[model samples]
Target chain A: MEILLAIVIGAAFGAVLDRIGASNPTVIGKMLNLTSLKLMKTILLAIGTGSILMFGGQMLGLVDVGHMSVKTAYVGVFIGGLLLGAGWAVAGFCPGTGLVAAASGRKDALFFIAGGLLGAAAYMASFPWVESTGALQGVLGGKVTIGAVPGSGYDGLFSALPGDIAGLVMGAAFVVIAFALPERLNPRGERLARAH
Target chain B: MTLSWKSGGVLLGVVFFLAVLLVKPIGVSTQFVIFDGILWNAVDSAVVTQTAEGVTSSNAYLAKSDGKYAKAVANPLNYSFVFVIAMMLGAAVSVWARGGLDRAERTMPALWRANFGDGAGKRYLAAFIGGFVVLYGARLAGGCTSGHMMSGMMQTSISGYIFALGAFAAAIPTAMMLYKEG
Candidate 1:
């Protein structure tokens, strides 16, 4: 049941992403170019809709806030984000979406999967060394997510902003960024160029 | 709109109902551990260890990414991986039914054929880096882009929003440098 639900959701998610031209690297590139905000617009829409639902659900006592979230402020995340950006620019697919494209029969997607698996293996094999190295470990020495949130000066042992409020803040921020900001360049032909 | 959210929702509902009613929930990462675990076991049994203190660990850090759509598989009954394998196959069927599949050479640029991509060995390097980075971010942040950013956002996760902001912050710069208007 869980698996079925997951596939259905995943498929819909993939379809939506596909329809919006997310599968196309050019669309992403254009969004980056300061030329178009279509991608940003779509993302803002998704986040906006999602947060609204969450907030409503929380207030109505329909959703479990604790189970609905993950740990926060992971230092490794920052470094990982830096690395992910470099790869997205070069390879054009993240792990989940790469599979989506491959299923869509894009040959490059297959290559992406193979590389991903091998890469995963390689990282595991080298974890001990990676931990010792200055590149990643240096940035996050003994700082685990949720464990070390740099003393907010609040004395409670376990505390975080309520999930709903956080969601509202994030949702509002995206909406502001999407509409307030002008096209970095010109919005011309970005839809056609990137999404193919 | 060409497609109604209701239709999509119904399809998902049906899939979920059926999955829960008969099959296990859809998952994908488990299929990987079969290959990954075996490789780890082959490399050094020492890496796959069970602590007397009851702290279980694998050399393969996939243990970190045991998310809703992904499960932790230590051995046989790696049913989760099996489920992901099924999901991917299901995805293929869905795509094939739509008559939308193509070869990479037919679409992607041969940028590496020149000396530009020589720095990274074509698809090999690109894929390797992509997999490594996405998962690393996923694990570090306690979720993949899907679980952390996409799913998190969908469920109204503040962490997801943070991840998204972080993603754009990084993506905006890199997307500019590597891809020139083409």
Candidate 2:
């Protein structure tokens, strides 16, 4: 039953990703380069809205706090994120988007998938040495939330502000920013047209 | 056939919210590791061994979490794995529904062509290298954009915010340096 549900959920997620142009590398590249802001706006809005719905659902008792998974805080996570960002700019596809692109019949995505699998293999092979380096060691209380929530196993960084409320406020901010962003920061096409 | 980005974004948000509220958060990077483990286990029977306790892997990473990953390796039909496969299928379905790839999609994107030219091989190589770097970093970070940035921020995890910061900090500059034409 759960597996069937997974397919439904995953398919919906992928379809939306494709509809929003995330399956296209040029769209991603444009977002990162500020040549186009459509994808970025969409992403910000999605994240903001999702955060609001999730935190709001939790507050309304429609969502289970236990189901909320908090990844451990570690130095490696931040460092690795930096590395991932560089790669994202270069390749213009994250794992999910890469898969979506491949399925969308973008041939380059196949190469990306192959590369990703090889990369995962490399990580598995070096897991021991990486672990020994202490980069993966938990930091900042291992798993924690920005603000405390009742029944959540994770600790809170700020006790005064409820985590759900914090999420809601931040989500709203994201939505506002998403709406405010211009469609294009570069407008190179328009500029070139004007020049001609 | 494509929805506007705004509508798509709302739909995506709703889907993500429902996934978390009803089941679990959406994640995809871990599956890459699982895929590797599965293939390795097939090649070398000793890579993963099932015992009375549970499935165990000779690989330390897979062996951690009480062999939870090893168990997934042995039984590859878990929710997460299936979800990833479904995502691919969904993407393919979307393309087919849209009447297949149009000329623009079949070739290089305008922005990419403006900066990098229309060499499919270059794009493929770049995509592959980029994917390699991203996945390698994801494993090191213990998550990807979906798991850590999107899901974590939704739940208000501090690590998620930190990861997002690091990602954007590097991504913006790299994009600037790489694509001046765009």
Candidate 3:
């Protein structure tokens, strides 16, 4: 039953990713380069809306706090994120988008998948060394949330503040920014001329 | 016919929210690791061993979490892995429903052509390299954009916020360096 639900849910998520132009590397490039903000805006709005809904539902008892999965805070997480961003800018696809694009029949996506497999293999091979570096060690109380939420076992950095409220506030900010952002930060024509 | 960005964004949000509410958060990168483990296990039976204790991998990374990853590698049909496969199918379905790839999808993007040439080989190489870097970094970071940033922020995880900041900090400058022509 759960596996069936996973299929249904995963398909919906993929379809949405495609419809949002995330399956297109060009669109991703535009978002990162500020050539076009359509994809970026869409991504932000989605994140913001999801955050609001999840946090709000938790507040209303429609979502389970225990179900919320929080990743550990570690130095390597931040550093790895930096590296991932650089790759995202270069390739115009993250792991999810890459898979979606491949399924969408973008030939390059296949290559991306191959690359990802090799990369994962490399990581698996070097896991011991990476672990020895202590980058995996937890930081900021390991799995702490920004604000405390009742019933969640994890501690909050701000114990007095409610996590749901904090999430809602942050989500709202993303929505506002998504709406306020211009279609393109710098005109493509202007950048082209400057390049020459 | 594609949905407008506004509608797409809202719908995407709803999908993610429903997943979190009904099941679990949406994540994809960890499956890549599991896939690698599966391939390695097939090549060398020793990579993953099924003992009375349960599935265990020679690889420490997979053996961690009490061999949760090793178990997934052995089983291979669990929710998370199946979800990723379904995602690919869903994307193919979307394309089929849309009457197949439009001109933009069929060809290199205009922005890409403006900066990089129309060489398919170059694009493929770059894509592969990029994929390699992103996946490697994701594993190092413990998650990808989906798991760490999107889902994490939704759950208000502090690590998520930090990851986002770190990602954009590196991404913005890198984009500027690579794509001066827009």
Clashing pairs in 2: none
Listed per candidate, the RMSD to the true structure in angstroms reads: 6.8, 1.8, 2.3
lDDT string for model 3 (A127-193, tens) is: 8999999999999988988887678887888888887898899889878888998878858735654
Once model 3 is optimally superposed onto the true structure by TM-score, how far is the C-alpha of residue A148 displaced, in angstroms?
Answer: 1.6
Off by over 4 Å in 3: A189-196, B103-107
Worst 10 residues of 3 chain B by lDDT: B102-111
Regions of candidate 1 where Cα sits further than 4 Å from its true position: A129-162, A172-196, B1-35, B38-71, B75-94, B102-125, B136-142, B153-162
List model 2 lDDT by residue over A71-143, tens digit each: 9989989998998898888888898988888888777778888999998888888989999999989888778
What's the distance in Å from true for residue A156, model 2? 0.9
Query: In candidate 2, how many Å is residue B118 off?
Result: 2.8
TM per candidate comes to 0.68, 0.95, 0.95
Model 3 C-alpha lDDT versus the unseen true structure: 0.85
The pairs that clash in candidate 3 are: none
Cα misplacement distance, residue B17 of candidate 3 (Å): 0.8
lDDT of 1 by residue, B1-182 (tens): 11233343333333322332343323232234346665665676654455554324454354343322112333433444444444455555555665654443323434322214433345555655666665555444444555555544544434545666677678778766665544
Ranking by DockQ: 2, 3, 1
Across A1-196, the per-residue lDDT of candidate 1 in tens digits comes to 5555454555555555454545555555666655666665665555555555544555666544433433344455556556655666566666656666666666666776776666556655665666565434322222222221222221111235454455566656655665665555645436644676
Stretch of 10 with least lDDT, candidate 3 chain A: A186-195
Which of candidates 1 and 2 reaches a greater lDDT?
2
True contacts kept of 3: 0.77
